[model samples]
Target: AFDPPRLSKRADYSGQMGGVSEGEDVLARWSDGLLYLGNVRRVDSIKQCCLVRFEDNSEFWVLRKDIHSCYHPECHTPPIEPEVDPNSWICRQCVFAVATKRGGALKRGRFARLMQIMKVRLPYQLSSLDWDPQHLTNQQQCYCYCAGPGEWNLKMLQCGSCGQWFHEACTQCLTKPLLYGDRFYQFQCSVCTNGPETIQRLPMTWVDLAHLVLYHLSLCCKRKYFDFDHEIMSFANENWESLLLGTLSDTPRQDRCQNLLNALNSHKDRFVSGKEIKKKKCLFGLQVRAPPPLSSDQSPFIAEQPINITHRRRSETGAHQDLLISTLNSVLGTESIQTPLNFSLFVILQPFAKWLFDLKGNGTRKALIMPILQPDAVT
Candidate 1:
């Protein structure tokens, strides 16, 4: 099995960073690219990952490269102030799920915890054509200077501000290391680092509705799907005029208002919305049902060949699947996916009840479980 490249320069066989003692304390990086309080419970020597149990009593395996420390176990001197918010503690997995589900529509509260993840010692000058979905949001390893598939072996660094990925070699970095392996630094890309003359820097304290949408949508596109509904509702809750003005507001690209729906229609492979319609006997009596949420080809195994696995079952890579289910179940505040109750799960996932209820009439087990995997089709 292949492993992803970790930024760890000196990870060790022992659980903690640099072989700090077992059951020791450490900071763990979540999907949104920020560190939070967690402690080392055990180590997966084979995967070179650690079983990190966070302060909230949630436990999962964090890649060794994603683990670090500010003041404990490791000997280090403070250069800059500790960056992560003391009050920013929340369910890290929940943050990951919400961010992924909404395509990174982070509300101001959840958005406040954003901090520096890694610095691009070198910057990639992107062409006007470089801003497409393929280059920016689609890849696992981003914020870097390449178009290559994510290589676990490569030493990679990600820009904390814009979330652009960088290959260590491209950074031309010799000095100015992470200094403390804390997984942090005030890093920006060429576009961001070049100063406000080149682009407006998103304020660290208060990011308005306009900036949140544009910044997350335009830059740091780790999550591709932007929740326009969330953006508008958020603006509407505050001020409707701001909603309209915010969409038309200036962006680093100096983009025109063509981004309203055109950009979304083009960038996202699909859009999903559920609505209940009442029919009062139409003139033609035509079936008024909406199109199938997923095409048969996409939502396969409802009746046929299976991926040969279930949410409970795993294959050669099943452990990872198990880990995901466990993490999501924990993050979602659910007991098990086998019992996907609406109140117990995240609101975004509430629709699963209806879908699964309908699916139950068909085949059982894997056949029912398979279609639920296509998130693109489901969402």
Candidate 2:
């Protein structure tokens, strides 16, 4: 039987082991890229094997030739004195990862240990930390609006409401990156968090307003009033041109006035206001104005308001006047114009009246005069 090489008995074997003793910290290079820093638990000189335990509580046995003293004078700065507890060792990679992941300053003990080991200065400014392998594997993949799937990039943000992930490019949120010190947790998508409905509802440009006016005029001509759909078609058919022209042209000076009139006359009983006709109903409750009398000077002067017509009733007058004023202020850009009651009423009601006349001819449509008011529209 062969005898074991005992360090106490054989001085040559002790010299060959490179001074790595039991219960001492060591750096072991197991492969070209893999390196482990651990405490030497046991030394088996008979088998030329050494048992080591790492910070992550993993143990391995390696040949004595692979292990180096943790404080090797040539490789690292020699410690002032040997550490009292060999178990208080931590790797440089783990120290940095822990500091970054916690988003806080490094621990005092770990910092002092790191200073002793590293010849170069530690870069504390680095933001990203290596995620724990087990934690990374357990995390759910992020899904972007474009259907891309992966872990969140630095530029990706999560919506607190929907639990969805979106890229900064997709969200148009090109704001600065959130700092660790900000302590912000909640985030919301644009649609989920409500804003002014008027922003989406209000017309953006003059062309948009023109389109809305034309749509509402067309609806009136079609007798598609929500409350009373049954009405005389003569009123709409007769005065369709005047109504269409007045409503469409803000100043009523466009050459297209005659063209629109001709179009309305040609269509007669069948009027198509396009696909989105339902949304045009908001302005339909406006009081119609009677056509202006022929101007003697031919300068297109404002119309004179009619007086004491038997058709004008006392109960409906107040409501109609209120509706007319609000419509002129909100829709027709007439908020600043101050005038007598007759002139103001004439200016406001003339376009609507012409449209209503085209819908019902000589007889007035009660439905056209009295509209179902929206709650917010009043006052």
Candidate 3:
């Protein structure tokens, strides 16, 4: 609703003027009485200049003294309203609605960040940097590819984060159209472009730091345990994934590690799912369940760790102890699940077998339990 005053008469006085520029530092003189000014400050009080062209393509400059309200060139409808009273421009109702919807005016720190994100660059450099989008308002526009399919005007675009606009080309990949998804827009920047050479070219930003933190947590879960004992040694033996995701090891502080460990431990119950088998029970003492069949591809070996064996005689009666051994031995196939019994081996492997069951989860655990038996060749 910007309304400029109607010009009563033209003034001959040419005072020194400073205004926003399209490109060059000098003001372009139009055929009509208009002087296309440059470097104008972005102030609400100083309104946009409207240049009216004559029959021969000459123009006359109309300052705030010549216009009442702006109309869309096509629709002729005023989309924005003017400030009725600057002294008390906002009413209580409007102020409350704005506050309620926007969650309050943005803080200056966030405001500056938004401005920086939306800044764009020109293909060619100019002497004065005043023409940059960083200094313009949302309504500002620069010349676009005049000969392109669509005669476009590169408008000052504002970022959703910072409410600032830059040339569209400067901020996005020009090779393809952007794809917008449900929550956020997905567009490849210089950092996300594919190819080994391109990947090498990527400049690290805050986004890279955020991704590193998430990836580190993921690998820790896969390894079953988070190990940071020897950083130098570990890095030497680390894989490609570790190198790409190894920012955490550089820091001396280990305070945040507990939080990562706690998260993994908390989710352990949800991680594994399997059946607990029941075995033959005696009158005096209870027998534990049989070992469940391993999922396909899983090995009886939970992992490559050393087998830690400990035995305790909770009951004095020989019958109770013998029963426990009998059940555990049977699980280890010592009693020859089908052929012959090997009692000593069963006792030795029982403890490690129990630990393997504890780590079972989804397909990985199921696959782990199943042994990778090799087929025997016919003689």
Best by TM-score: 1
In angstroms, give how far residue 212 of model 2 lies from its true place: 67
Tens digit of lDDT per residue, candidate 1, span 301-378? 211122111111214223333443554444445655742222112223333433444444553455445554444442
Q: Of models 2 and 3, which has the larger lDDT?
A: 2
Error of 2 at 221 (Å): 74
* Residue pairs with clashing backbones, model 1: 4-152, 5-152, 122-171, 142-165, 143-164, 143-165, 143-166, 144-165, 144-166
Q: Top model by lDDT, which number?
A: 2
Model 3 lDDT per residue over 266-332, tens place = 3321121111123211101101111211121111222111211111222322333344345443434
| Model 1 misplaced stretches (Cα beyond 4 Å) | 1-16, 70-133, 136-377
TM-score of model number 2: 0.17
All candidates' TM-scores?
0.34, 0.17, 0.15
RMSD of each: 17.7, 33.2, 28.5
Candidate 3 achieves a global lDDT of 0.25
TM for candidate 1 is 0.34
